[model samples]
Target chain A: MTSPSVPAAPTLTPALGRKLHPWPVRIMHWTNAMAMIVLIGSGWGIYDDSVIFHFIYFPQWARIGSWAAESLLWHFAAMWVLAINGFVYLTYGVFTGRLRERMLPIRISDVIHTVQDTLRFKIAHEDLTVYNAVQKLLYIVVIFAGISQVITGIAVWKPIQFSGLAEVLGGFQGARLLHFLGMAVITGFLIVHVALSLLVPSTLWAMLAGGPRLKTPKLEAAE
Target chain B: MRSPNRPATPPDAAILDNHRAEIRMLERRGILRGTLSLGSLAMLTGCDISDDTSIGKALRAMSSFNDFVQAKIFDPNHLAPEYPASMVLKPPRFNAYYEIEKIRPIDGPNWTLAVSGLVNDKQAWTREKIATLPQREMIIRHICVEGWDYIGQWSGVPLRTFLEAVGADLNAKYVSFQTADDYPSSIDMATALHPQTLLATKYAGETLADPFGYPLRLRTSTKLGFKNPKWITAIEVSNTYMPGYWEKLGFNWQSGI
Candidate 1:
């Protein structure tokens, strides 16, 4: 791979893609991302609704404070949206076979070397096209994180029905702790995702426009 | 140029040659449409397999463990404070489940409690025998784990008197309560003899309903709603501790609401 990276005069040029993201994948992916953000924000609101947080309490509008019944309802509603959207997206990805293409990490040594080179800043920005191993791992972890939120959240919501579950996790209190921790992890990951998007402008377009663009020579070598 | 087996199926050779560039472009950029499709598909395999592989075992362990821990926490000798009727939460909420099926029989002088276990004496006490011994009354909140609270007045004979009657063995660490409903619960011997704990029959001036453990019930303010067992039938001092149904299932065995 380094042999090809010898700073050779341009031999390959990028061609614009006619097909970007498949419509379903694009829709579901973006929606899932948005839904998670809303859910996380609303979850924070609900958690703080009951407690008087540092120097501040939730405004009266934020909660009826009529024994927290309203906050509880909001939590349940947001949870349903996040769960349903995630389920549909996951199902479609499997049935349609798009998951295979997007999720499989680049197995070739060349891609690994390319990632190392990019990390070292040895490779020019042009040489980067394939997502590095780190990206693949983050994406996968987020998917599982969403799952954790749902499972732990259920353990909190209906400790009796899911009592058996509550028992294993050390009961309702334990489940609540896990649920809060899961949200925190997701929030941290989102911060990193946004930073990366800024680092590489193409990331935004790639998701929005469907296919990422490789500056010409890399595209040529790739072809 | 296709082989006979391929016979008219679009030849891989031709398609490969034609689409190789497009495929390369898609692959190189990682802008492929199927990223989530692949990830989600893999996750699908993980989804249906209920995560609680050892849920049953954990439940059992926890129930027993909770009882053991709660026993260790409170010295049954020191009782929870019983407040006057003024301290009761007004409009007491009826939460969880409360019911009564059997009442004290008319001319009811003979509700008896059996004490058996690692004790020197195994005996049964008639209601008349218990009432004659010692009586205590106080009001306290029944804090439900489900987040409801209610305070009710209770009057009952002390469990210590029963333990003293049976002469519980010094080594006995646990006390098990067998309710008339066939629902048996156990707590630490210390919890059993808690000062505020009682084998009580009267609730708010009337005999407890069968659902409320009619003849007698155990009440401890330190623990959550469920710890208070109703319908006292048999009290056994034991060497080992274990959890009841709810505790085994996943609730905090201590369950101090």
Candidate 2:
């Protein structure tokens, strides 16, 4: 077996998009999904313990780890998983050119058209291998949100050690606020992404089982 | 990330192996069996598939790893930022496990800092005696693990100076403090020797209030506010790991910022 990101002039062709969700991508995606769920739930628990906005509070059932201390454990542990998983995903994206080919060069006109199609209830799902403009935009924004969340999280976690990062990110309070906002953005993305996947169950299958295969296959080489 | 799978549709053998691998992992972890909706997906992912004592153990291990990381990254010379006098909060915000009305008042003049454990000089020093030591004042942020912080001026002898003066085993694993408030907290040797760690007797140029750490209190820049024990009674330098009040109740013992 070869590394998913490497250009192997061999099995599992990308032509029919059979290589859409390689094992690494699939594993990391699922792992990160679980990690994000844990992080978000436990983070909410921690926030509720000593709330930033006193009036706003997350319900207990939606939270992980019975209390704030336990929540912190879940949060920190999940944070490591997220960090490692994210780093791997990023490396894979860059090295394999998946990020450039699938998620870049987003044009305003394309975004507008995608929105128009969605509004008219004419959403297209003909090509499961490729991302729509809206999908690309959403993915890009959430990636930024994830990056910001991690940065602010570290700053809040150790303001004294990462003093400059804390200061730049707005100290203790500001870093927390940014982190909170990042969670909101990611949560929103999850709702949309999940709903879309469920709406077109084929996308879910694509992620789960590598979707469709070509009748006549060539050695998968091209990234 | 897992290695590339050869076929678009995995064969029955691969499927069976994946299931076997998942079960093996769960058995290896000794995790409590629960009806996990996505158990297969969560396998080998370093995530808790269900709520159980197993996750708790995993988290405790992570906390210990973090403690190691904290110590590894700690710099002896790096000082926590000092604030201006204007930034110092006069009559700083009060926080204790108990209520303000329940503050155990102490007679400041009669207070003696009893030193014990791994020290050449185990004599008790009175408030007057500590006052005579070289004083270093700093205005640093007092941060709470609860996510609030305050800049307050604390003036007292540096802990490094006091530890050396007392002929303490500077290499001791822990420096523990027992407060009159019945709160006990301890810090690592590295943090104890940090230039900003102070046996602060005064706040904002005046002696600490009775509700605060009157007579004497441990003020550390790098630790959580709870680590700063108030209304001190005794200091012990020990090689043993002595978990403090909150620490025993599940807070990280090395509660460094």
Candidate 3:
């Protein structure tokens, strides 16, 4: 009753799955996901509140909150999370060479081949450790899209304080347009991403658990 | 390419008209298809945007709900930050529904600001009378609903002073303004009483140019540029709600920064 005994370390077992995602990447991934959901929902609420596009009216049910003020509160609150998490993700990715290691060495021919392979329904399921050329390209595009959204968002939020930035984006109206387009593009990516995840359920499981559940060929061979 | 010598004929005109009709048909199909998707989504939510009246009502309800939330959080004592004089944009950009050239020149001498509604002193205020009131100046950013902003140096009598001088019922729910340019707008009593709310008579140390509101204009640092009605002609204090020019057109009524 006085002191609890420390348990001995268990015997090492052979590795099963490859480490597809590090802890930081997985944590930031989920945080970014939550932030994106709030941002998009509240953003739609704001759009309905002041509707820049007359032709397209997003359904009221899709709104994040009942009121514009409420939506704005949610939006700004989520914005801070997204910005900080994105900054950390980018910095870590760059410094640790993870970005270059996982997403780079992508060639034009590789992209062309990936597209052909995808269209032919012949995407190889063997390699979960590395992103396909198309996936890498999409990830790169999403990174730029996120950056653009943040810039345009700042321009719209504090036009007076960041007048130069707004001007660079072709003034406030231009920034608003760009911001909306970025959201649409991100939404498109999210749809495709979810669909792809459904196709390979392990990818989602790997992201959630931080490693693949099944042993890779290399790991099995090593054992 | 047609032969240079060939004369344009009725059959050719018929063919052209047929082509035009086909294009119109295609355009209509595209629009119909887009609306069909939207209508189906609306149906899923049990809110039909197909009917104009119901959609308008829904939008209005949402807007009013926003107004209530904004009013609940509004702080009368909170002041918008005053920018440095150096931040003031020279030749502040002209903004309005119409072009600058179309601005109707108001006769400054004949212009009398009529005050009405829940006020005890419903006197017609003249430019001379307004100029006599204690003046205040500040360089503040003018944020527009369209998303642009510009810092401007504005000098005028504090709106609170004008309201007190006129014996306005500070307890009233709202204060409305009618501009000479046919724009009608209102602010919440809390915002109206805010210290930064100004009955601006000068811009950039000079009398307001025609492009800007001339003679007299409401310049509040707390609200958007559209909320600051240019060439203000009348002021009314009321307990009831009144929508402004842009507010009537779906912009947020409580458009605080």
TM-score of each: 0.43, 0.85, 0.57
By the lDDT metric, which is better: model 1 or model 2? 2
Candidate 2: clashing pairs of residues: none
Please tell me which predicted candidate would have the highest TM-score against the true structure: 2
CAPRI verdict on model 2? incorrect
lDDT tens digits, residues A1-223, model 3? 1121421111111333436687889999989998888799879877775577789777867876555544554566577789999999999887765676567668999999999999999987666776888999999988888888898998776553455676788766778889999999899999999999899988888888886544443453353
Instruction: Report the lDDT tens digits of candidate 1 across residue range A1-223.
Output: 2263474423211223323355676777787776676466446545663332355444533331122322332344446668888888888766654443345534557567767976797634442344455666677778888889899876665454345676687666677678877887898899988987878777677677766543344454465
Error of 1 at A134 (Å): 27
TM-score of chain B of each: 0.65, 0.80, 0.80
**Predicted complex 2: DockQ:** 0.19
Candidate 2 chain B minimal-lDDT segment of 10 residues: B40-49
- In model 2, where do residues sit more than 4 Å from their true spots? A1-17, A213-223, B1-52
Candidate no. 1 TM-score: 0.43
Chain A TM-scores in order? 0.69, 0.87, 0.86
